[model samples]
Target: MHREIGPLRALANGVFCLGLLGLAGFGAVQVAGKNWQVQDTYHLSAAFDSISGLEPGGRVFVQGVDAGVVEAIVPPSTPGDPVRLTLRIDARLRPLIRTDAEARIVTQGVVGARVVEIRPGSAEAEILPDGGVIASEKPLELADLMQKASAALERLDTVAGSAEEGLAEVNAIASAIRGGEGTLGRLLTDDEPVNRLVQLTDRGEQTLADIQDNLDALKNTWPISRYFTRRGYDDRDLALYRPNASRKSMTISESDLFDPGRAVLTKAGREQLNSVAEWTKEHLTKKTEVVIASFTDNSLDDLMAERLTQQQAEAIREYLVDNHGIDSAGWFRSRTVAAVGFGRHRPRMISAEPQGTSPDRRVEIILFTPQAAS
Candidate 1:
């Protein structure tokens, strides 16, 4: 009976140890995250001058959509160096991010934690590649505001002191006049001084009129005219910056923008793009968008045809981005530039000739001008 009891006691200890191991494993899993599955995402990085309150695990928003999270905050090497932030963004929403997209540190509330907000660059801009390093802008913090306010107060104090001195000087002059101490006192008693003061007032008014004339001349010039006369027309200029104000569409043969069926840009293509970029940059506002669509011959396999067209469109977009930068308002009169490949699906301009000709292989650039097309 003693030997049987000894064997049963050993088995009971083994069972108790297994129960403790199971509890430890469960605790580890719970600490990891609520769901054990890993999310499908891509990585992006940005450098900021200072991210004072940004923390790891902060939320990232894209145009108000919760699109990603901050993964880590890397310390700068030197005191004045920029801090690098790692971001884990959704893979599917990659296209929304363009080169012009900007990252900023934003606050939850008056005293809440800080989060990063990503404003999408443009609807027509090229998608940022995975693991790309983008630009970042630092938001104004409470500390910075306080420092500015303090400086302003110091200036106010200086101005107040100067004003007090000015008042004292004016009082001294009045007292001198009352006592008839100087030339000003003599002028107060003479008609010649009054005539001189009238002459000085007339000169000041003429000087102001000349300055106004100079500003009007500047407004009529090429560079200054754009800003001063943003209103180009009469009250009917309601369509100046509207989305559908003046829509213009044109189709360029693949030969004009690219080699036959190939995506490599030729000399003429570059020239065409330079002109287009300049025109688009000048006319496009923040809200405007530009779309570049590519086409291919229908004779090829459907998949290959679609893929080729897309590559062509992407090639054009790449050129535009590299030369023009991301099309957005923040980046110097930029507009959102996007690209799509139709693959012979929508051939608005049918080739009058044979099916083998490469006219079907073309690119269509649709421009949405903010102002009326002249």
Candidate 2:
């Protein structure tokens, strides 16, 4: 081994050794470069319920293009808090990343390393600032899916068993009926049961008719008759007709249109009525009816209060019909004008003031329009 060698042979061996060292150095540089922070990059973060296999140094993609890398993963201080991921992204993508952009953990190809995938938000959204957190979609876990599938199968099995039991019970009942072994079976087999059922139905119809007749007669009787008249139930046409549910209304305070304790409209009240007439002319249709409801805040007895409010409501109706030429006849020749009085018994309004405050005496003019026929 110590024997002298040729110079040419020695020089060739030295060259081969140098080549091997260079190759090793090149590989070392390549390995370190994977974790190196590239220049001209910006930082961003996202929160996820679970990162699962995603880790630091993972690549980040935007719409299938390589755009950045995951710089760090911060575990939550609390057990239930989300896992946070810091990302180092190319500065060129800064304008494309929006506040609404969503991030998710995904794998590249089958059996490849996990990476972060960002879905760029709509152009109308504001751009996300550096170091800002982006929205994250929870990563789907294979284990969780499997557990849910197993639970679904268990429920299906239970349902199938119950269905089988129900089928057996149904078959047993069918067999009993076929054998004429129960009351239902007997009723199906005999004609007397059918005849008896028909007779019972006839009797029930007669009883209902008698009850209806009694109610009609009661509606026409003494004290009750007055109540029905006030409610507009005395008119058979109005009682049977169903109006459309939608309506428009205008309210004016009693003091605005009338003097205290008087149902007569003041001069200002006439002006207010003229304005209401203009509004009604714009919105009124042939199928629409007018309703005038008046309320009073006076301390008069119920009878006197009723009379006063009635007079007030009638006055407004008369002025609209006589002065503005509003029609009194509505759809199908029915009386479209309805005037009602609630003396000291004000119905609730949509724009009512707070409770514990006494409301002003007011008048409400409402237009009830029928729905268009199909």
Candidate 3:
């Protein structure tokens, strides 16, 4: 009985030892599978405009040395096209990676793993510490570069075609203009037009010469004599040409005609003139009151106040003659002459003493026959 009891205890002990060995084996396997060096790895993140092809578990290298692997590739949080990728690398090589160090995706041999490679920048660059990020030079994937190059080539082709078309159109337009095919054609090709222009120029010259001759003949006459030949009178009718030879004399009653100092006529002088005109019309013969309200003074303030010019005043005079009721008589003479002469004589001296009186500023005239002498 004692021998049988000892055998049973030995069997139970063997079973318990086997069980412990099995548990130890499982723990070892878990440790081996963990594979990550916790204290050694440094973390960094890089952003790309577009990460078309990249995957986790891709190898990370520093100047060809295996440093780390890609941890994650995060898509852009926003709507625009951007991507962010995270990497974990060993901390021991952090001093080798400068702040200016760049990261890029490169392939191993022919069938090697895709890797995140670092090209250590200048010696002047600061060494990148553990978990510090180095800038990523964009990954050079052949397919993406090819696609962009293809698009650029297409745009270049389009621009070249447009430039060719523009050149052709410009050439055609220039050819047409040179050939004189349109309205410009007649201007360039017609010879009769040139002849007609020459004839017109010659006629203009002849007419101008005739006018100059007539002017020269008129100037030869005296100051008070007529400068134009009578319309109905001819050379044979020279004796019949009663050339207004008699200088009709008259006395001026109004004192404003000769002011104290100034030569220019005044506004009050103009009003007094009109008054004399009214009196003459009420009691005199048929004579036109041609009152040209001429403003010839050189005063900028007066021009501004009136806001009308000499040209405008002349236009008003023309309008009155053409549209209004001012009559035209054959001969012009002084109102003083009319007052003293025989053609329905009437006279009145218009007073000059009035408010807002501009002195010696206007003219009043009356028409009369020389035969009607006082």
User: Which candidate number would show the highest lDDT if scored against the true structure?
Assistant: 2
For model 3, residues 282-359, the per-residue Cα lDDT tens digits are 433343223222222333345341333222223333333344323433222222121111111111332222134432
Error of 1 at 56 (Å): 0.9
- Lowest lDDT sum, 10 consecutive residues, model 2, at 236-245
What is the full ranking by lDDT, best candidate first? 2, 1, 3
Please, what are the lDDT tens digits per residue for candidate 1 over residues 299-325? 878888877887787788888777887
Local accuracy by lDDT, each model: 0.70, 0.74, 0.50
Q: Write the per-residue lDDT of candidate 2 for residues 244-339, one digit (tens) a residue.
A: 435777888888888987989999999999999999888887777777778776678878887888789878988887898776454224346667
Model 1 alpha-carbon drift over 4 Å, by segment? 1-40, 77-81, 138-141, 172-374
Provide the TM-score for each candidate, comma-separated: 0.39, 0.39, 0.32
TM-score for candidate 1, residues paired by index: 0.39
Candidate 2 whole-model C-alpha lDDT, 0 to 1:
0.74
Q: How close is candidate 3 to the true structure, as a TM-score?
A: 0.32
